[model samples]
Target: MSRLFGAEPAEEAPSFFLEAPRTEKALERGAAGDLRYGLASMQGWRAHMEDAHTACPQLPDRLARWAFFAVFDGHAGGTVARFCAAHLLEHVLAAEALPGADEEDAAPGAVAAALREAFLALDRRMQALSRAEGWEPAGSTAVAVLVSPRRLYFANLGDSRALLCRAAAAAFCTEEHKPGRPRERERIENAGGTVSQQRVNGSLAVSRALGDFDYKAVAWRGPTEQPVSPEPEVSELPRRPDEDEFLLLACDGVWDAFDAAGLCAFARSRLLLSGDPQEVCERVLDAGLYKGSRDNMTCILVCFPAAPGVSQEALQTECELDAYLERRVAGSYLRTGASRGAAGHPCRLKGSAWAGGREGRPGRIWPSRQASGQVAWSSLQGPFGFSRAIADSCQPAEELSPHTDYRPPRVPLGSIFLRSRRGGGQAPANNPPPRFLRPLSCQSCTRTCCRRKRVPAWWACSKAWPQSQIPASPRAEAWPASKSRAPLPPSPPREHPAVRQPPLILWEWPGLLLREA
Candidate 1:
């Protein structure tokens, strides 16, 4: 039955994927001297967010000349990641491994040693905390970098990554510590563990990380030689301010979607579009979701004095692209007949879904200003600056419904374009838009699935189509927006008669619904 409907085998599916992803992002931005940084994180398609980061533009007291940044990608649970983000810097500073205020001339090796000790120290502290708190078995991959005026010190314990961009390209990146790596595998085997299917003992995917006391139970061996060692690999590189562009740190969530060179180019192009580092980081997270990554995503982008700048030409080109999309959307409405879709059904293009609103309610969103018949486009504004004229002209007041049938603007498949303003050149064909452009409304009811990349869950419409293949009334009264983060009501379990009787099947076409006979 599963094969006939093309459902993924239950065993092969990821253990933590949700029916839909949460698209909201957490953004932070700051600047210090020639160093400016932006950080963005999203819980994309994961059951829980487990990614955390640290960014200190200036270290305290005598260490003010140095800047610290790191990303932690947690697995099994989020406790370790949050703990590391809050305390890793303090531990690093207290290690006294770095050059003193008077030792400005200390060799780069000193910095590397200091970072290594810091990672080990943090792991040791976490071990004690885990026992005290009685935490569930969990661990986190950590990748960090310390930047001084003269050099960079990189350290890592697992698969999280950091990259350095120079001359508009990827100059260097840290190596990932996967369990399958030759050296990593040898260590695991010596520690009485086996590597199978690229995982340690067919379990953990990474060879090193903080926490995971279960793997540190080798009483005869030292902590550093355990199956899953917490000791980090550290390296040092001389800084090249003349050619260096920026530094990027991210968890596997972002790396799973891009290679070092590809990500560098993508980040550079976004920087050209907007000099705001936070926006650039948001774009990276969005792109990662579009590329089908199923993890908690976090990214930190630190720009140097030589980073790319926004260009007038690129901005103009972007505006033109927006105009083109608007024209196409308008023409599509005209061709399909005003306020209707291609199949003669009333178009369900609910504009309110484009903005923040109640999580489980459809056609209800926060208003920037009260307008009797039309929603204010200002509140729904995105990076593209979609024109109000086009939206208003295309959608009549009567056409706004709780249920959304998202038909993307009829533009060419590869029509989207991006250019680097600094280089004054066009980028290669990449960054196709995600399938769904806005949150989806249930075709049978008013419930909302507030995600841009995945289909609405079956339960979103279950109240109306409880046990029938027939469609129910699609009309619903819009509710006033509320400021709340409350969880949506749980749907009936899969074994319930309503669900078991006739399985709800998600059709391949975006926003379309079908019921299995």
Candidate 2:
């Protein structure tokens, strides 16, 4: 009867649960300058270890002043993750945007650009290799940190993350890119794709990744425009020698069990107890396993110069701070419906509110202003009862007030045209319009009004505008006008002999000039 019905005889069912073999625990240690680092990986309940990591005490010859570390969490197979562990740093070293070994003072923006390009290039190479070798579909999430003498740069793709523990609190962490996130979902849909059940197309779990060629088949889309792009989000921050304690880089296997604040506090406690970074890492892996993580676990712990000497008192203070921040963030999220912003800001804590008065004695805790002008909590106390500001010293100056207007002095028109020629000649076909000229609204009337007005299309599109217009190294101007005012009609397009066609303008406001790309 079973054979006639097409049913096979039942055999003993194979158990879905499996335990990790004890032999897979891997560990390594190294040092670079005052930084001591440790790395560890363990195959927890997973059938096989698909996680890979790298820790370099010193980068290749000319780049010896820097160090590199990363964690790659692979799914489906381990090939892509292992490949990244071996070749990712080499690609970064060869990136065109990276400064030469002797370039000690390279611009932060340039360094970040180099890292971004390298990540994309690595993904492209991985795709080409898979196609050539006829490899199966596989991909990995990567989180990397490059430590230079003066700065620390981070790049992340997928859910793997990097975190900085500063002054006994969770300071900085990479944002996870998941299909369910609003921005990630929008990008996927824009590329003619769909997200279901927090996964891309109900199969892949990550929105962005290093190798997964199946999703990269859109012929018209650039690398970044693909639904599962490998392009990483890169950022740089100055090295904070005074307050920076350590850095933690881990794959999702570990992150699934502990949040940024919880992990930092736990690591701090373990570090204080052992003073050995390797031991701290081992303990973290054990903690994750105890928490029932089913994936392969990997983590790297990097102790800064200040870490070894952190007194018992400081450790206690940091734990207190971590607890306090967790409570504050939870309360704020409930009251204001605003989630924690990047770098541990609880509902957008203003810098001025925490800067505190100089007259306040050190080590004294005092109430500071909240977003609503009500006092929220006491300021963090530094070592020996001195008052320490909560703001990170490594924060870029521009971030202090990201919306500050740039004001350039009025300049004559001839120089504006001349400067455009010198600053890179004609703009490229796809060059985006200046921030001031971009459309302000999607309304049809607004678009029509913007098209009717005439401003110097070249002036708005010029790569070097106010600078070229000024005599002798002029500064860029900041247009401070309101962005929502009624559109103003300027001189009609084609008023200049150099411009033949009436340039199309999309939107315009009273104080700002705008043009269509």
Candidate 3:
């Protein structure tokens, strides 16, 4: 039996027979455009509530279309989790790599990089606060989602997870970082830490977390080299309005009780019964509690524009109408002899009539041609109810443009440096530096680095050594000295001889450069 936060190990399992005088439940619900979202949390049988969550339908004013949601499961105490809930999203917004609302080159890889840095920044802030306030050995697992109109970016650390339900199934999920996993275990051991009985150093249960200060005590090692790292694994997927249903983020308490498929099925069934996302989240928490989850439970549900429960009947009717119009277009084209237009191109249903005449006041169908050459059917000007007949007969056509066929850029996994370590001394003359380390144009680096920190053109030492041999530290001296430059800060004290400084490496795509042991 492992102890928590330096607490003495118990010979027998601790009992939580005593229940709280009152249940602690929190709920939030909102909408953004066609999307709807809900969040719910319950303390369950636990003596104290240690779970926290966040929901934002729209980000800061600068990034209006973006939304964010997250769940944090705390162990040892709830302070860490609460802290993360309050600041994680803000940090993400502040990341230098994150794209703006209207940036044309906003690629998925850049968004993923921003997410990774956001998690690391949160961890760093917690660590710094813990040092000053003498906080307890507390930590939290986080799963967060950043939703844009066209894409969804996810970041995960520890056991909390983000899952996507699409086509009536769990289409995507973030992998949990557990100590028992082979790769996680290997990282722990390599960092001079141990995993015994599936617990980190026979204590912490997770391999990666937000604020476990004790596990991060190897001063000679970089942040990622600690027994528990805060670096989140980030991934992105294109949003499919036609097929994607909803996204769910939950703590281990919910996940421990239900697998991805089971939860998606349950949520979908509930959504059909009641179109309210808030009610669905409440039911999910209740289900986790009923299933006997041993820890505090938290869950957040985000419904895409196409998700169930939001006017499903109308959508179905629209689909049927679209099919009918397609058939009508084909039939009319054949009957009208496919007349040629002014430009000698095939005229698409230019003079077709659908039973009614142009003089009809209500319930009349009006045909229009989109720029893409697709035919659209709409109701003629009339009272609300009068248009229903024509609206049900024809569906609106989707607008298309040259950029409509754009797909999410496939970022090469190798391009996002998962782990970058500093080499000892200097590199050999024959070999070139990695692509990421190579000197990029100023504009490229500015766009890539975001706004948080300004990176130098050639991020290397001021000495004559090759750029490849430059130290991995972000604080490396700049090559040029401007007349207006401020004086350099004093160097910190040297480390103890017994503690060796490891090489610095970039970790998880293009975020957070860390030293490795």
Candidate 4:
């Protein structure tokens, strides 16, 4: 089932499960900075949404965030692969954050330990269930990665593999851990298993993994008698600051279609036309299907390029302050009866706002007084001054423990537009507050109302006239009265002399002024 509101129907492909005695699955989050993943199932070689992901927008820096993908190839059934999908990374991260774990340190044995524990835990639970359900232990091949800013921990069990493509470099390029490796062969032998022609017990193809409990049994009868060691060959590579390129983790299904180098070359070529990882992923799927993969095919592509930095921290601060003003403009804290006119002190401003000051929440946010970094009577009284004054630093309202204090970074008021006085000019220190800010209706707003811009229109029927307040008459250009940032509107429109529209005067005035004045 698709999670999206109107998702496209999932496509069905022939199973490569038995095609080359391998399977594959692919997942791509793309360069758009999204989080998505998928798993291929044994039946029909169909893809399953085993686990999906959502990107954390709070941390926009790609380098600061972590991303990884995996592919689990199951031969007998998908029980083991499905189990690993849900729990492998779970155990690794738990191990990464282990007590006294140094972020920089590879935490060498932690991954292996986590792998052993995770697999043992799963095996125990699976055995109990398999006994209850009367089903034999199902096995799977696992290949996965856990990536961070400084390094990646790639681990594999069984035949599924993980490959890396160095930036602009050519090669299948990744360490392969298979049953043939001396250490792997030894591990199996030491556990009382035989390896011939790189196959465990001369039958199973992988040396390490979870759920093959029956094979590990010294006595082929029960859990205590036989158990899968599930010790993954884990490698921690301390990456150069910018050495990251792209990574691929695929089940044998994809390899059956494209050799190790062929898969890497295919991924490299697609990235040229479009950097869409999803498209490249589909291309891998197409390749596998084209090659007649009979088992489930799953491939997961993880690319760490960069993230979009459209709005800077400066812009976010600006927008945050802008949104703050919206609360003031809404008169959030003032009641209807608080208006100066309603209080019968209209013309002469009064300061009755302080009457209800201590009634509600003591630190209640108000549109007429100061509270924390909120707008204040002082700011409204000056039209262009900040509540706490520009020189003041952030301070907590009360002393918590002597060791703990709540304070924000010293925000530099810098060049925030205060308020406007005469039409478009700055409000002077001595000018009386606007009628809106009188005692009964003291309006305390952070952003100046004059920051709005009004661009000029070319054609003018009444419909053509600009909607916002114009800087020049109703017939002219408009701009943020308080901001000098924008250039003045283009010299009044150059209109033909025969144009008789008043609203079009600005458009026609330029030529008329040039010709006559």
Query: lDDT at 161 for candidate 4?
Result: 75
lDDT per residue (tens digit) for residues 164-200 in model 4: 7665443233444455778777666666777776567
Q: Top TM-score: which candidate number?
A: 1
Task: Report backbone clashes per prediction.
Answer: 0, 10, 10, 19
lDDT of 2 at 175: 85
Off by over 4 Å in 4: 1-64, 96-102, 105-116, 170-181, 196-198, 219-228, 306-517
lDDT of 1 by residue, 1-517 (tens): 8899998777865657665567688999998868999999999778899999999988888877789999999989999999999999988998876787755677647888888888888888989888998998999999999998878888988888999999988999999898878999999999999988788888888899998889999999998899999989888788899999999999988777677877788788778878888888987776565434667899999999999999788778667755664454444323322221111111233221222112222222211122233322331132223421111011112221111111112111111111111211111223211112222322222223322212242323222211211111111211212221222432322332222111111112112221111
Per-residue CA lDDT of model 2 for 1-517, tens digit only, reads 7899999978877632242223257999888777899988988666667899989978878788888999999988899999999999988998878886755667648888888888888988988999899877989999999988888899999999999988988889998888888988998988888998778887777899999989888999998988998989887877889889999999987777677877787788767756889877876775555333556889999999877543687567655754654354334333432212122111122121111111111111112223443322221121112111121111111111111122122222111111111111223333322221121211112232334322212222212222111111112222333332343432222222232111111122223222211
Model 2 C-alpha lDDT versus the unseen true structure: 0.60
- lDDT, candidates in the order shown: 0.63, 0.60, 0.59, 0.42
Instruction: List ranges where model 1 is wrong by over 4 Å.
Output: 1-15, 102-104, 335-517
Residues 64-137, candidate 3: write the lDDT tens digits. 88889999999898999999989998898888988877645776488888888888888888888998999988
lDDT of residue 423 for candidate 4: 16
Q: Which prediction has the highest lDDT against the true structure?
A: 1
Where does the lowest 10-residue lDDT sum fall in candidate 1?
388-397
